[model samples]
Target: MQINQLTRVYRYDGIDLPIPPHLADDPQGLRAYHATLYPAILNAETVDAGVIGTTHVTEYRRAVGTKG
Candidate 1:
C-alpha cells in the first residue's frame, strides 16, 4: 500500500498535529506511530485545538492476459 496524500494536520484529543508526508503505509504502523505521541499531545496544555483530518491511499495493479 502507498499513501497518495495526507491531510495538512490531524486533530486528536483537541490537538492539531502536523502530518508527516512519509507516514507508514500499514494501518497498524500508522496507529502505533500515533500512539507513541498521544501521551504528550493529550497531556500538553499549550497545544491548539483543531478539526480532525484524513489520509488518502492508492493501490496500483497491472492487468494480466488470460487464455480464451
Candidate 2:
C-alpha cells in the first residue's frame, strides 16, 4: 500500500496515539490535538520514525537543546 494509505501512529510516553480520522493529513491540527492530551508535547518535536507493519510511526520527542 502507498504511504498515505498506511495508518499513522503517534508514539508518546511509550504509548501509541493513533490519529483520528478527522485529523488525518492535518499535521498542525494533529499537533494541537495531541498537545491537549500531553501538555509537554507543546514543546516537543515531531520525528518521523518511518513505516512499521503497515503503520507510519512518528514520535513526539522532547526538545533538549542547551541555550548557548
lDDT, candidates in the order shown: 0.43, 0.88
Q: Give the candidate number with the greatest TM-score.
A: 2
> Candidate 2 — which residues are off by over 4 angstroms?
1-5, 65-68
Give a tens-digit lDDT track for model 2, residues 1-68. Answer: 64357777898877897688999889999999999899989999889999998888999999888967
Q: Residue 3 CA error for candidate 2 (Å)?
A: 9.5
Q: Report the C-alpha lDDT of model 1 over 1-68, residue by residue, as the tens digit.
A: 87554434444554544445567345445444565777543332332233335533221112336647
State how far residue 32 of model 2 sits from its true place (Å): 0.3
